[model samples]
Target: MSQPMIDPFGREVSYLRVSVTDRCDFRCVYCMAEDMTFLPKREVLTLEELDRLCSAFVDKGVRKLRLTGGEPLVRKNIMSLIRNLSRHLDSGKLEELTITTNGSQLARFADELAECGVRRLNVSMDTMDAAKFKTITRWGDLGKVMDGLRAATEAGLSIKINMVALKGVNEHEIVPMMRWCHDNGYDLTLIETMPLGEIDEDRTDQYLPLSLVRARIAEDFTLTDIPYKTGGPARYVEVKETGGRLGFITPMTHNFCESCNRVRVTCTGMLYMCLGQDDSADLRAALRASESNDLLYDAIDEAIGRKPKGHDFIIDRRTRQPAVSRHMSVTGG
Candidate 1:
């Protein structure tokens, strides 16, 4: 009914990534500290509230919706939110409803997700080695994730593996991981380590630029640029040898903010226009102020108007502090 959200740079904001919960089962070395404090349940928006907020975005011309989190599947009764949002897909108002997860609980939720009209999932898996997986994800079991992946495929859910290119951590696993993904009929996407939140280890030791990874892949495999897009920032290429698609998300080496058409909302109802910036609008306050959406719509428009032309992200070697104080999980990983 209203005009579609258009940022100041003329980019239409059609993709919305919402963080259902900030609580994750695993504390990854790059994502969170071993011992972390999570938000109180009272502060988080209820499942019904999330559904209403998401439907509001769909009405405002958001065709693609991605549910992200500390691990979206870890949230209790998350399937209800998925099923409720599926109505948008049924009514032809939304194009897709996808989830980005760590694959810990996919084994239990994959079939339900597919049944609820979720066609695709982005699973974050850095290494196939069990030891390395344990090291990366402090509390994760490689066996469980592997089982989850198998179950996801069996459920008819298209999966894309999102591997963060860690310098010395998983750099050696790139070729192996790519091959594994292709062998299992899954697309592989390598993402550069973003400078967000303070972790146990220094990020400088883990920052692996995708440009370097691309050159390394070229030595073993022929990569041809492709025009494939998944409503995200990843630039894709086709691997001639593997006959699979490889995507590169270079936030540090090369930023892709010029074409950013997405915004993120935390589970607490904070709308973030940019991931690397701290500017945001508290939509929860607006939502609670009234039962009507008149105030919510106005808050969304004001947030879009304040969206920056591009985010300014940097990984300083001298200081270990992150560009943004909020953790990646807090911003809807």
Candidate 2:
């Protein structure tokens, strides 16, 4: 009864990214508008529902499950979902159960997370400068996030710091951020800003190519290519000077779509086979349509069959519209 989820491109879907909620504590300039409208509580799936959907994916050959969110830790009683899904890791059906957080709530839940079988965490920290961090996240507290990171490190969670490479904003801090992460014994990943959702600023001005970043990094540090992957699009290199690893997720400068094997589901149970595409399958309707999971599995199979070969992500200066109108948070990024 273990049916493999394969796309039309013959890519076996082994990774699932589920958005536990679309709510967050900070309003990052690139991610969301200051004034945002969130979904009603009734519209969002319950913790129990999330566990069931995740379990279904595990049964269908998803070896890794990552819980994302506007900020995943902000979800109420989210640890319960993590605890429930830990059963898969216990049974060896799932290779990993991880969470992508903003480090806002890690201080409160790090120990519980470690107890629930979470070995790794991805924390989005754009800049180390307090003023710059506030300007980027709008409502974020650098002190709190740092405290959370310390707690997570103490709790035995391997942390990766994700920094969005913005052109004029925080570009100067890239090297400093890398050094800070390396000093703190954390891996650093530089991501090219994707054209997702309509924000207050023009993305053309915000878009920073990783090619330029790599060139700048090469000037300072020696980087060696390494065969490293985390079931995501980031390609890795070992920093020879620091003896640490660095990852680059270049969706714009480079396309890693050929090896794409992951799908994302929103908090409302919408399944997106491709991150840059808007097409989604309504797993909620199928789940509520019946108590049994036959419809849910069938829905997932249909969605995978129609998965596009690659996403069409272009940051046009004239248009100034996002490649996808939905925010990265909405798509579980």
- TM per prediction: 0.99, 0.99
What is the lDDT of every predicted structure here?
0.93, 0.92
Please give, for residues 6-108, the per-residue lDDT of candidate 1 as tens digits.
9999999999999999999989999999998899999999998899899989999999999999899999999989999999999999999999999999999
Name the top lDDT candidate: 1
Q: Cα lDDT of model 1 overall?
A: 0.93
> How much does candidate 1 score in TM-score?
0.99
- What residue runs in model 1 are displaced by over 4 Å at the alpha carbon? none
Clashing pairs in 1: none
With a 3 Å backbone cut-off (N, CA, C), the pairs that clash in candidate 2 are none
lDDT of 2 by residue, 136-211 (tens): 9999999999999999999999999999999899999998888889999999999988888989988888889999
Candidate 2 yields a Cα-based lDDT of: 0.92
